[model samples]
Target chain A: MLDTLDLKLLEEVADLHGLPQGAYNIRKNGQAADRKTTANIDIITKKDKPGIDIVVKPGTKEESVHIPVILSQSIGDLVYNTFEIGAYADVLIVAGCGIHNPSSEKAQHDGIHEFFVRKGARMKYIEKHYGEGEGTGQRILNPKTIIEVEEDGIVEIEMIQIKGVDHTVRDTEVRLQKNARLIVSERLLTNLEQTAISNITVELLGDESTAQIISRSVAQDNSHQDFHLNMYGYSKCRGHIQCDSIIMDQAHVTSSPMISALNTDAQLIHEAAIGKIASEQLIKLMSMGLTEDEAEAAILKGFLK
Target chain B: MLDTLDLKLLEEVADLHGLPQGAYNIRKNGQAADRKTTANIDIITKKDKPGIDIVVKPGTKEESVHIPVILSQSIGDLVYNTFEIGAYADVLIVAGCGIHNPSSEKAQHDGIHEFFVRKGARMKYIEKHYGEGEGTGQRILNPKTIIEVEEDGIVEIEMIQIKGVDHTVRDTEVRLQKNARLIVSERLLTNLEQTAISNITVELLGDESTAQIISRSVAQDNSHQDFHLNMYGYSKCRGHIQCDSIIMDQAHVTSSPMISALNTDAQLIHEAAIGKIASEQLIKLMSMGLTEDEAEAAILKGFLK
Candidate 1:
């Protein structure tokens, strides 16, 4: 069964006009309704893929579940295929390795869109890429997600790359109807190699629609990273993209966020900074007898803080 | 005669107790010897020629007065070379530059170094390099400065560049005595194809001495810039080097801040970053009825702020 928090999130999505009428329908399979708008899958461990495989109506609110375990550091590209977001269901929970697909470039686009379409739901998914073992490869695992939305829906998506991951790339695309909205937030931790390019594109088809993308990245050592964002605002929709990166050591970071306003009043702002730990600060700390590692850690903490 | 402010700053330099001594002296021409420890000299500024040309005794205090009506931008560096700070006197002053340098590079570095070598003086200098005309190829006017400090003296220097400017380069070198201290700071703002490279080297010959270098540069358009800071921390002296640069559009920036911490406990830190404007933020601002130029200006102001 669905929990209260998940229910609340679904309600919010529905209330936000993120779904269209008749987008979702109830269906049954065997002794159980194969897709229950109310029932939530308990868990989908690798030992037992016991979680419910959902089929969403065009525009129904779906259950939200937390998948804590699906992270493989070595995977280069993971494509989400075969999952469709229906017009009725407005939410999708990618609990485990949401998009940390190493090989399948179309995993999220193909796998995830299939479920959304079957469920008839406008999708809002949170993909967490977890890592195990000593992560190698300049290419961290990436989960590529694609969404095809009907008219008048919304999608709020977030991707957070925790520490200990090698590198990560997030490529997401959204096709929105009139008055549709998409919000994407991405957070990147330290320890990734260069070439961590995160690309996001939101295309507004409907009039007065909107999209916003926010990205934050922290780089240390010889890491090289880039954040590329493109928002195409058509039909008089408004769009925004913002990226911030903190560089430490010889780490190299580049951010190029672009917006194309095909129609009048289609609006966009970008800002970036590069700085080093102040030396007076280091001397002040070293004067206190803290080791070099301690001093570096303190500065990093202070910078993030 | 040396004023109270000048004397106080000199005292601060002398108090460091860890720099090459006798390298800095003050002499006053045509003045009777007196009990005052300050050296004050009188010199006539010949038209189109440097006013103070003189020498100093080893380990002695000398002073000379030269009031040149030069551009404000050219004062510091010119002052540096005129007195040969590294070879002789530590302090030089050109009463004031009543004229502004306008867009001339030769004018800016004219008298930058005179007050820099004063015993134990650590100071910050901020320069605004904006002009109405197009920026030139030669942005920084070189001013020679020579300094041999006594044991246990200290110096800290900083230069911040803001507004639009052309190419610039300044060469600086320092040799420290036992237990001396020295710090240097450089900041650059370049738009278009401007290129500026500052070459600085500090040799720490005495034990227990210290030197630090800090620099920041911002490049825009097709501009290219570089920084090279080399420090040799001989004996038990400490050396620290840090440099950072931010590039936008097709801009390119590089930094090579190297430090040879010959003794244990010597340390160095360096960092750099390059990124373009965020698209989402621009869209957001544009949605607020701001033009693209206004949005960019706002972001730049906020970033520097």
Candidate 2:
């Protein structure tokens, strides 16, 4: 039972525009609905399988496919989903998970997604996790994402979590083949006693492979955040990791980025900074007639953006 | 007796071009020589005084004075020095300590310098510490610098230690008053089995005060380095701390920068980065017919410069 607010929240987090009348859509971990024949995408369900699979065939002319799995305010069971993207398919996938727990008897969701990118294929994946509830129940989400990029394949991922989750543990692991490339950009904001931990590991196994990982986070009001990224270079490759965070009001943040190389030609680097808001930034903004609180809010918005 | 090599090393560190015939000069922990009337600087030595004092009177017109205290190959004692700059004085002091130990016994130099800058004065100080020896004797240097910037005063300090020291611990502390400004730039390079630790603290006690601290370091082979900087803001002030390091071949480096504020208008920020050389940089240099080692050396030179 989904209402207009539920749909709007799902659309905001999952990039859903209109109703699922033409393209393929899945609702509440259910079967595919309103499937299009000429869309080059197929959704199938096993007779006794617990999760559904959406496959994008090779050489698909479609630019992207949007599939959002949402949970409503009622207490419900956890959902599991998987995606299989074919080789040589140049497309984008807009996928995310949104939970609205107003009645709140402790709602939870655990999504495990694995991606396979074939040779010479390029994929852009964007995922945003969000939660909202007025009830006293806890909202928890634990996500595990595994990605593999074949030779000459390129994959770019952007993950964002702005608010509302009480606790989350995100784990991502990636492997790159010869000449493959991977880029991951993550942005998170935790406020009011929330907790977030991210563990990411990348391995450059192929010659001339490259990887870049960037994380930006903000913690306020007794929140806690920990981020760890490790990159291993086995062959002649390049890698760079950057972590930036802002801590305010008894909040605690820790960032540890490590780079290890077994090859002589491997080049790797990492940069991390954790501090409070700069006074000059606030002064410059407040000089334009805004209050101190307004200035801080504006700076935080710009930093997250 | 100072030979050609000794003179060259002193000149390299203190920028001494010619003998001081009119200005004060000190060598080997000795008293000031070549005292002149045109210079308003006085060197005072008292009985049982552990360190010598050089006082610069007000309205001193001399642009710069070079004072280098050298230590030969013998197992010697410590050297201490102090500086007192009067009000309304605008001058530069280029001072350094170089130890050439070619013996079997351990050699060390502990130089402690304190500076008192009166109100409305401007001073620029540059200091370099270096050591070289072929024997198994340890070459160690521990230098402590204390500075005070009065109201409307400005002080800029640059410290450099490139090579040859087996171990070093550099400690610096500064206090700034109303409208006062202080800037400190430190560059260090540790190779082989050497180690270095730098601890710096600054307190902004007056409104409109500012301070900036920057550190650049490189560690290679089995060397280790640690840097810590803390800034406390008691009024409306601005401060920034930056640390950049390059680690290679079993070298370990750690950087911690903390900023605390007691007032509402204090703004502070810090940034730190540690990593090895980038592959693209090496590739770009090698494409121009340079070898890997040559590219790395060039990059290191440019970074240190």
Candidate 3:
């Protein structure tokens, strides 16, 4: 829900900008980063197509310079719908990846990043995962991202992933320079699927900078949710994180939120929590005449309370 | 921090079994349930009073039936240690008057509540406004709790409150069945004055039920922390909770955890995390290169390319 819709609001912001490649230009001029180029090799990116079907490889020679990057991916149906995040690209909205219908997802999962990369743009990316079919089995989508931010640049990424029958493997990378800032928020709701692994990396190669990460999740039934957030802080840098999870029934949730401050004055704090519901507490409420939904609502509300 | 070795373990499991009220028992031939008496508006029976300076009141009254009760007061510089789940009579922890500290905190911020409530006992109570201390003032601690469960049954309650400059408030209630369960977890890290309105109500209306709650806290930079938790459940039930908090740069934190369930099949989960570090993200690790903490370790070992 939005409070108000101001169409020209982006133009008012000094750093406001947007991806220039319209859908048509994106389809025609945007091609995958040149493939064939290899870097420190890791299996996750080994297929070399850079995980893209079209065999374009990363250009030879590392960009060496730190450039702000934001990763974006969406999983579910609803592919053709348009998404808008102010012109500055601070908010990333992702939709469209068939995760619920196993048969449809087998075809392929497509990601759109070439448009921004080709423009040499630096901005935040918002990723959203939603479902269209009734029940958890009809929709599923999985996507990964990579982002690099330059000095004094800022990248804010917000991802909301709701699991369907299909799972998602999200891997995002960001390299920041001196004084660069990055803020990432990942929210996940998992019901179906064996697991959801979110792998994120941020290199603080920069000095006196800041990075913030926050995650909230709900794991129910037999679902498994794992999150790995690691931030390496330089001297005089400030990094902070908060990770919270709610587990139900046989559901299991694991969170590893860590901060490594190599330099003095690198104030950093990391925290994680996992646990199940209280039954006797619920019965006491019921005995008080509250209905089942009321009880669940009350108990569940306390997670936020 | 625990007062004794046994208190250490008790802090870890108080949520599963009711905190023990050692030697605080009613004379076997003293009074019957209907014959119990009270002195304060708040009710406490002969069974709940120990050899203490102050008592809240006496007698236990059910909405429909009456039960036995007890009361006791904690003196100055007294770090009332932890209590075993199976070593004492069913009890309630309450803070009725006010508490004060000299060095770390000032007055104008005092709260009250019973530290431990017995299992298989119906309990109810409330606390007033709570806050921070002033120059040369004192710090206050007021927390109240109740427990009800069968032999070996358990209940635990944890709270944090910071309201005004002169005082604070905390209230709790719990009830258990022959073998019911309950647990409480509270964490608060803040500096500003805070008032807490807390409650915990449970009914052991069943056999073999349980409840538990845990509180974790870290405060720095002159901030105040406040928290409150409410728990209630029934027979053969089980409950667990964990709350973690960290404060920095004169920041403040206030929290309240509530648990309520109905049927014997009820199972609940609650977790609260308050911190300044996003430990599960790779940004911190990439920033420092060291990967020893849980979040960093997961990224270095489990989060591949």
Docking quality of model 2: it rates as: incorrect
Better structure of 1 and 3 per lDDT:
1
lDDT for B194 (candidate 1): 67
Best by lDDT: 2
lDDT of 2 by residue, A108-212 (tens): 767677788888888888888888878777777787888888999899999899888888999989999999999999999998989998888898889999999
What tens-digit string does per-residue lDDT give for candidate 1 at A85-173? Answer: 55566555543232233432222211122233322245666655444342233324555667665666667777765554455566777
Clashing pairs in 2: A279-B267
**What's the TM-score of each model vs. the native?**
0.39, 0.62, 0.38
User: What does candidate 1's lDDT look like per residue over B5-88, in tens digits?
Assistant: 333322332231222132223322212111212343322232464344333322333343233222323333344223323223
**Model 3, global lDDT:** 0.42
lDDT of all the models against the reference?
0.48, 0.77, 0.42
lDDT of 2 at A260: 58
Q: What tens-digit string does per-residue lDDT give for candidate 3 at B1-305?
A: 11232233222222213333322212111122122223322233323333122232223322211111211112232212122222333334432222222344332222122333344343322222232223345444444333334444444443433222233344556555556455555433334443223334444356556566666654444544454443434333555555555544444444444444333243544455554444446566666775445554454233111
Please give the ranking of all candidate structures by DockQ, highest first, separated by commas. Answer: 2, 3, 1
lDDT of 3 by residue, A1-305 (tens): 11111111111211124322111111111122112211321112325332222111223122111111111122221111112111222322222222222233332243433212211223445555543333333333345565555556666777765554345666767666677777888777777544677777666776766788877777777777777776655545666666777676566565644444344345555545444555687898999999977987687665543
Ranking, TM-score, top scorer first: 2, 1, 3
Candidate 1 regions exceeding 4 Å error are A1-54, A58-62, A65-79, A95-122, A135-139, A192-194, A274-305, B1-305
- The candidate maximizing DockQ is 2
List where candidate 3 sits over 4 angstroms from the true fold.
A1-122, A131-142, A274-305, B1-305
Model 3 Cα shift for residue B298 (angstroms):
36
What root-mean-square deviation over C-alphas does model 3 reach? 17.8
Per prediction, fnat is: 0.00, 0.07, 0.01
